[model samples]
Target: MANQEKKRGIGFYLLVGVGALFVISIISRDKNTSPTTSTSAASAARPSSAPEPPKAPQIDARVTARELFEAYEKNEIAADNRFKDKLLEVSGKVDNVGKDLLDTPYVALSTGGKFDILGVQAFFDDASLPKLANLSKGQDVTVACRCDGKFGNVMLKECTLK
Candidate 1:
């Protein structure tokens, strides 16, 4: 009968639809589980704007923070030749411990004068936050950092407590 034929046709299409779905799911599963595909997908999911962690350079010099500041104040060009872009270990009393305008943590070390406004400014990375949190004014400390020359103050970057 035509009615029986129509039912069989509908049932056949239903079965075919299910088979097509099963095939698609298997193909998708294989693609998702592939090593290359998964690795690339994971990398793609990471934010492009995320910055890499800062790396500390090898120490190239060691001096007191006051000595470092005086060197730059006396002659910037000579100081730059001696210390610019080089890692230095500077020791001094903490003038202040606070964040810069950009919210970067910094420790201002005294340059041997009570009312001196200029000194060595050591900027630390996020990883040094815990150590910096324990620091206080007038506390003697030593920092290892890259000498970035002077900009109002003798600047030290990528600093870590020593």
Candidate 2:
């Protein structure tokens, strides 16, 4: 009789454990299915309207070629992270206004030495080639550019004379 009671108790515990697991699995399955169905219904209702295009990021700061060089000299990684991908309006003496290795037009802003080696390099859009062609060494120019961060020198892309 005692043995039969012990066996019945073990069977009851096993059944309870299985029942708890089944309930938990069903609850979890329902939770997982609900979100997917709601998302599908929401998309089906909004199929015609397209999402808006993202706006261009605003300019973070402006500085001259000398100031920009000084910032990088002080802390290269910090300056790169702070100014990378930000729009800028930089004004300085023209160092070089010519073609790059890829034949793309560029305007180098002087940080006070050699034209090509020690300066901020600003690459122009194809439309600005004619305007860039007119720029000469030693002339002052202010250009709006998207900063590409410092390599050997500070680099700017999509530059336009301002």
Top candidate when judged by TM-score against the true structure: 1
* Per-residue lDDT of candidate 1, residues 108-153 (tens digit): 9999987888889999988889999999888999998989999999
Q: Among these predicted structures, which one has the highest lDDT?
A: 1
The clash count of every prediction, one per candidate, is 0, 0
Per-candidate TM-scores read 0.66, 0.61
> In model 2, where do residues sit more than 4 Å from their true spots?
1-57, 114-116
The segments of candidate 1 whose C-alpha lies over 4 angstroms from its true place after superposition are: 1-57
Which 10 consecutive positions of candidate 2 have the poorest summed lDDT? Answer: 111-120
Give lDDT tens digits, candidate 2, residues 9-112.
99999999999999999999998777687778888898577778998656678899888887887998898887878898899999878888898889888997
